[model samples]
Target: MTFEWGDLFAGRISGMAASEIRELLKLIDRPEIISFAGGIPDPDLFPSAAMARAYEKIFQSNAGAGGALQYTISEGYTPLREWILGYMEGKGVRLGLDEVLVTSGSQQALDFIGKLLIGPGDLVAVTKPTYLGALQAFSPYEPRYVSIAMDDEGPVLADLEAALAARPKFLYLVPDFQNPNGVTVSADRREAIVALCAAAGVAIVEDAAYAELRYDGEALPSLAAIDAARNGGRPATVIHCGSFSKTVVPALRVGWVSAPRDVVNRLVLMKQAADLHTSTINQMVLHDVVSQIFEPHVKRLRVAYKERRDAMLAALDAHMPKGVTWTRPQGGMFVWIELAPGRCGVALLERAIKEANVAFVPGAAFFADRSGANTLRLSFSATKPDRIREGVRRIAGLLETVEA
Candidate 1:
């Protein structure tokens, strides 16, 4: 008889599955595949030179090296948290150091929030076709999900109001150029949504991973910012998860969470228990880099990514059949596509890779209710504009073949 490790696994393990996009990303290594499956940053855009200098400066100083190499506090480096406070204040949300936590990445922040708030059969609200990573993080904790359907202006107000009526423990959303779908919630809707959730005594977890990557439209205030306004610039309902991965680089895995002091305190304890804090050296290096060039670096990314986005939209328009439709995102890494009736995204992905040497993520993975069979997500962030055009053309050609 085989030694069954499954018998000894935690019950939560049963709810976790390998990420669908992560698996598809493996095809990118083959060289022949034009993969748009993962919404990862382009390596070329990473501030490799700045990062090298930051590390060199750290090690050159004996005092800096000693502290960096040593384990640090779970609450994260104080100076970094201070920087976060300033950044949040810029967005009209005021935060104290005690209300901040430096997480390994925003992904960890989501997991911590899930563990903090979710219990077996607890109700959680999520946008329809939400971030797959969030669903993955929360699933292990075993909360049932109620999904709010989204329109171009963001989650439909009627749907959100209905979801809130169920008395969920929290509502999770990516307000700024949401993942899988590139829709940003309008300013007025943000206000209405904040007020509704606050009134219902429901917490909001705002994932701002792609907030700084906008290419069009004026920047809107975050949910935290609006909620803070309700209570004299203090966090009232929103827990914001922010990341440097989209703007800077992902390898260092630096992200942060800001919430009310008590919530942050609990998360800090969880952080201490999970890994005894993020890498001290990495945190210091990240702090140094962002402090020096965060804005200019993000500006550069916006330009480069915007070109690729235009190329993808153009290619889709030029090649796709009339029945096919896709969203024109103002910012972020993804373009969401919806096929005509009776079509399937998964089937199209299989045929695209096999016959056209292209790759993308089927949108059903992002749906907590598992309903988006004809929808898919394409990422233009990593590929060059020419390659993005080629990839979209190939996928469109393949899609046509399937229709025939």
Candidate 2:
């Protein structure tokens, strides 16, 4: 009569690991803690009023209410897909309406891309300290990872060429203001990567979630754009994933993939089996809100996040002891910090919560190889400037203690 649930679980379940940031979020709920662990957008910038108006407008008429509330095509709402096409084209990555497949969020697109491309023991090329969520998304598929080294501009071309020799299932890149690291691939490097990958018959999964969140420096051409240019405006070699969560509203859960027609079709099949489709009402409302106020809203976010980033950078400079270095991100929510040699970020995190009352994600979680024990990622998006200053100061104090 006893139930043994663990014995009945699938083999893939064993490969899954909890996200460290998600776990840390549960323990840092105390109002007194100055948490820098989550890459969350500031709630103050959400377009609540505009979203409300869009929702009200959608329900104002019978035709509007019926269409929005009803289940739609698995490919996604047509108008939204068309709008995204125009948006991508404007950014230099030309996409037809058929090339776009809307998903619950770009997170879902990651999962679908993994499902489409990765198989057990297949190799995937990734940046050394890439996005943590990508590693988590691909882990259940049981793929091996080849981490290419990165420099200030982006992945080292020589290292990338060596990795490409393995003929990975695909190369995953977070091109603009990459998560955790906040480094953007330069335009020249983007072209080189595209040419090399295309020549080698490899595909690229371009996660552009934070591409639109730049705070400084001139914008670089996206890998998708360069790929399109190389392929004569057809994105045959790239599966570009983008999300509205960072630039628009996170709660809306709207994101999309722009790829070749065949890839789009395959992803649609996977998407249909996964969730039928993204929420009908949410998609409609997102399309409405974006049509009316996207530019102004994103501009507001850029200004706000830029200020927070500046504050964090200044605080780090003023407080951090010698040998503690960090990246000066051009834009994006995170700043990657490296502690002095022999320092452990995981150990520092434990003491940070208990003694310093500040929290951050250890860098090990972001590395597919589980290296970078002396590094950490600090997110400056959700906290106020004053809290950012205090948090960095507290962290700097902890580092000094470690040095002593």
Candidate 3:
């Protein structure tokens, strides 16, 4: 008898689906394809020399004398956690060492959060079109979703209030240049949202992955910072997820979460069961790199990505016909586009790849309710300016062939 491989899997695996972006990335790997499907940073902007020096310095130092090679505390490297606390302070979020836990990446942090907080059938509040990765992270834990309506400013207050009535397990927000939408929550809404959640006894999970990538507009206060101020400098009601993937290096996979002390302890226990700890060598090297060249490296990324964003926007304006619209983000790497009425982004994706040699993520994947069928997300982070322009032109040409 043939073995049935599918029967052995856990029940939770049934809810998991392969990432659409990951699957799409495979097809767009050919040299001729122009892919705007991935929210990847440009390789050119990586601080390779600085990173090399950091690794060299780490291996040459006393910390590397078998110390970094050894297993570390689940809470993370002491000095690195301290450094993260200081970093958060600079962002207006006052966090103590006991309140932070370092994870392999912000993605891991999301999973740990789900493990600690989510219960089967618990309602998880989110924006209508949320980050796909977050949905994936929480799906295994089996949480119901309540997607709040959003406008240009951010989540609408009325919708948020109604969602809060359900007493969700937590509210997940990507307020700074959100992944697929590329829109920032206004300062007023940030504060209001925190206060509203606090009043309803709901936790706020603030994903600040792209908070530091601003190329235009003044920086807005983080939801974590606002929550801290509201609670007299104690961040009790919000958990802030941060990453070096965008600002520093993604391959290092260093990310952190700041929460209340009790929450941190719980998350640390969950993390210990997950991977023992994030790589100690990577943390040490990252700390050294940030100590040496963080500011300059981030500044370099801002300049390069801004150019790419401008190129993509210019192409969209020049090539797109009437009835097509997209967001003009102040910073970050994506431009969310809406096709003419009755056009489906998922349907267009296959034709776009085969005919135009261009690829983008279908916007429906980002929606918790899976409803944005006419929209798509284009990323300008990976491609060069000229290629970005050409890719947009190709996509625009394909749109012309799409019937309304």
Q: What is the C-alpha lDDT of each candidate?
A: 0.94, 0.91, 0.91
Which ten-residue region of model 1 has the weakest summed lDDT?
A: 395-404
Over 4 Å off, model 3: 61-63
**RMSD (Cα, Å) of model 1:** 0.8
Q: How far off is residue 356 in model 3, in Å?
A: 0.8
TM-score of candidate 3 to 2 decimals? 0.98
TM-score of each: 0.99, 0.98, 0.98
Of 1 and 3, which scores higher on TM-score?
1
Which regions of candidate 2 are displaced past 4 Å? none
lDDT of 2 by residue, 1-404 (tens): 99999999878777689999998777557888999998988888999998899999998999999999999999899989989999999888877788999999999999999988898999999998999989988988989999998888899999999999999989999988888888889888898998999999999999999988988888788888888887778798999999999888788899999999999999999999999999999998899889999999998999999999999999999999999999999998999998888889999999999998999999999999999999999999999999999999999999889888
Give the number of the best model, judged by lDDT: 1
Backbone clash numbers for all candidates listed: 0, 0, 0
Q: Summarize candidate 1's per-residue lDDT along 1-404 as a digit string, tens digits.
A: 79999899999888898899999989979899999999999998899999999999999989989999999999998889899999999999998889999999999999999999999999999998899999999999999999999999998999899989999999999998899899999999999999999999999999999999999989999999999999999997999999988888898989999999999999999998999898899899999999999999999999999999999999998999889999999999999999998899999988888888999999899999899999999999999998998898888888778778
